[model samples]
Target chain A: MSTRKQEFLAGARNTFPLLLGAFPFGLIYGALAVTSGLSVGAAMAMSAFVFAGSAQFIAVGLVAAHAPVLIIILTTLIVNLRHMLYSATLLPYLKKLPQTWRIPLAFGLTDETFAVAIHRFRKNDSSRFKHWYQFGSSLAMYLNWQLWCFLGLVLGDRIPDASGWGLDVAMPITFIGMLIPFVKNIPTVVCVLTAGAVSLLTLGMPYKLGIIVAAFMGILAGFITEQTGKKIQVEIQV
Target chain B: MTANEWLMILGMMGVTFGIRYFLLALADRIRMPSPVEVSLQYIPPAVLIAITLPAVILPHGEWHFSFTNPYLVAAVIAAGCGLLTKNLLATIACGLAAFFAYQILLSS
Candidate 1:
């Protein structure tokens, strides 16, 4: 019973909390980028063009440190490597569409968008325009990110120590909520715990390499556990 | 904006887009082997935990797993809330409130 408009609105509506979660992140990026030496126009343009929150923040810091353009772009690639996982994960749901539809949808993908859109795609439905749902989530994230960036820029210097404000807590909190449903099986439980432990152990890796390392460790652990679990079941049945 | 500034931002845009679109663009051309395909479901939770656990348990990017850490205390409370309520809104509300309250208490 979902039309395109309804589907899109549902995506935006469900994305409301995450929008709040990202608010301070974008605001801090914009405010901090300006305070760090980038001109206001350049900062805004970065948000408009790059649109990746964490990368933009790191780029701002590197620019302040006078890092070369090649280094900045390289760092952007490594940091955003996570998005490729998201894209790959969602490909099954989106591959049937044309380039015209896929192009904008891909451009709008973010962690929040992927997190939100994935759930809808997983849902049992018969709607012909489910991509519109992702379109909604992606557009919401994009607009929300830009608006917060603008505010942070306008409020530059007025908001000092934006990072110290503890608003980043939203990311973990929202993520925890999203993660609970995924912990419904033994392999998933192992995955979460293994990932958690490795993250703390590898906390010192540069450029957020620990995240990538820990994620791989968790996935490996989960895969092994699942295989062993299946073997045990087969033996028990025999 | 200066040419260098423009170069930096545009380069970032290109790379970010390229990475995000790489897999989607090649969905038909590239198919992951079955084992890798089975492992795909684990990616979201693993990556999310890898990101969140460190942020919560090691809020300051160092090991301080004690009652003094407001982020840890808030996150634990929030997890409990999430488990009991199974509601995203409630979880975030409790987590943020707990974080701010614990921060104020520790400072004063």
Candidate 2:
């Protein structure tokens, strides 16, 4: 296969698990959006336009609540601010790519795409094939997302929201599953616990700003813990 | 709604694409601070907790919690199942069952 084809294949392989996981989420979102008073068109449009699962979930909820358009937009911005950081982390590697490649790749960057791409990028130093890996990983996720959205739109209302379906919990369960593997150290543990506490305390904040605060606090806690660990190591060496 | 009614939808799409693509185009021109990178890691967990906590702690359509609240019980069961099985499908099944069982018990 050509280099591009090889990369696409690799991307598909890495994204297989993530794509499977996201399928139920798209279905759930479609069902929820319909029940939440969004027309099928709006629901499908959201899937097509936003292309971010969590953001779409939030958007549907906000629309249902009759939140002002500006507030809804602002909430979406805050919720997705983390993507900017994802962009920053990949900056060093992506900076070397052509503008055409970088722009398209950036549009394709989602949690699954970033997760798979970063794993590959960190595992090897094959600088020449960076875009190939990114393309491979992101393309699979992108296609998977679009496919699931389309399926959901077609059969969403008929899916039936019930306990037996158990699709609503897919998202939360997926997140917990993802988090467990990453909580490999004391710093990560501390950050999660501290953030959880803060988020709980500020749960009533309007517009979901508490989420932003909790995330900020968790990041701060993680950074501080890392700095402290480094200081101790330096002290011991001295 | 008709296609003509979807001008707003197209606008939303334009805005989204702008956010995703604009940052990449501007990456070389501007640098993000160290703090921004640090905070990004916590976003997923924080957002997850934020969304989940209200569903459990706050009863639907009410600000307070009570024993009658099935979501709370279901959430506890769900969390336990999540830790034990470490399987998404299994955990969700457990949670959904617990939630419905509570609702059914209360109604009956």
Candidate 3:
């Protein structure tokens, strides 16, 4: 196999673990989207175009609620704001690629892909085929999401209460599982704790604005904690 | 789909794609501030926690911290397993099993 093919396969292989978690999540989103009054076409279109799982989920909910278009747009934007950070983080590694590669890669960037791609990028392999690896991971995830969503849409039609099956619980459980491995230091712990607490407290907020608020608060808390810790270390040294 | 729904979907596609592509498009011309760079490291955990906590702790959009709330109980078990094993499949399986088992117990 060529080096590009090898790197591509490596990307797909490394993403297999994350795909397992995302599959069920995508299924739930599809079923819920249909149940929430989205047409099958719309649900699939959002999955294809928006391509952000959490944002799509929230969008379907907003549609069901008969929320105004502006609200749906704003809410989805807030939910997906993390992608900007992802873009920023990956920008340095991706700067060398042409527009053709960068456009698709940007569109393919999701939480799962970002996790795996960043790992691959940090290796700083001397090979010119690193972007192919990321492309492989992105393509795998994108296709996996569409397939599961289609299954869920079909299943949702036959079973009206699929969302009520408590399958949605898996989403949070999976997230917590992902979150646990990252809590290796005080800053991370503080970030998660603050975000969790704020989200819980603001659970009743309309349009799920609480999520955005909590995200900002958590980032702020983590930044301040790190800065203060650094200052204290400086003071102690002096 | 209704025209209104189509509009929403298109608008979302625009916004989401715009955000993901923005920094990459300007990769050479722009530099992220140091503070923003440091804080970006925390975003994955913070955003994930923010999204997950509400769903786990309040599956029904209300406070359900009592033992009878299977989601709350199952989530704690799942988090414990995740911490102990650091395995994705195990964590999900343990969580689903706990949730279903709790549901059975509740009905019984």
Best by lDDT: 1
Q: Report the number of the highest-TM-score candidate.
A: 1
TM-score for each model: 0.95, 0.76, 0.88
List model 3 lDDT by residue over B23-107, tens digit each: 8887878777888877777777887788888887778877777899998899999989998998767887888889999999998
Please compute DockQ, using alpha carbons, for every candidate against the native two-chain complex. 0.78, 0.31, 0.69
Give per-residue lDDT, candidate 3, residue A37.
Answer: 87
- lDDT of each residue in B1-108, candidate 2, tens digit only: 656326545545555556666667776776668766654555555445545665466644365467777767777777777778765456556766777777789889
Q: Give the TM-score of candidate 2.
A: 0.76
Whose lDDT is higher: candidate 1's or candidate 2's?
1
Tell me the deviation in Å of residue B63 in model 2: 9.0
Candidate 3 chain B: minimum summed lDDT over ten consecutive residues — where?
A: B37-46
Q: How would you encode candidate 3's per-residue C-alpha lDDT over A1-238 as one tens digit per residue?
A: 3499999999998777667778778888988887788888989988988899888988888888888899899988877887887888787788878888889999998887886777677774588888899999999999999999999998877876777778778778777766776678898889889988998888778767787789889989998999999999999999
Which segments of candidate 3 are over 4 A away from where they belong? A68-70, A123-129, A235-238, B1-5
Per-model root-mean-square deviation over C-alphas: 1.5, 4.5, 2.7
Q: Write model 2 residue lDDT over A1-238, tens digit each, in one string.
A: 2376676688678667667668887877776776767777777767666677877777778777876666666766766666665676677667767788987787777766776676566565554676787887777777777787767766766766531354554454444444444455777777777777787777668656776677667767877887798899999999
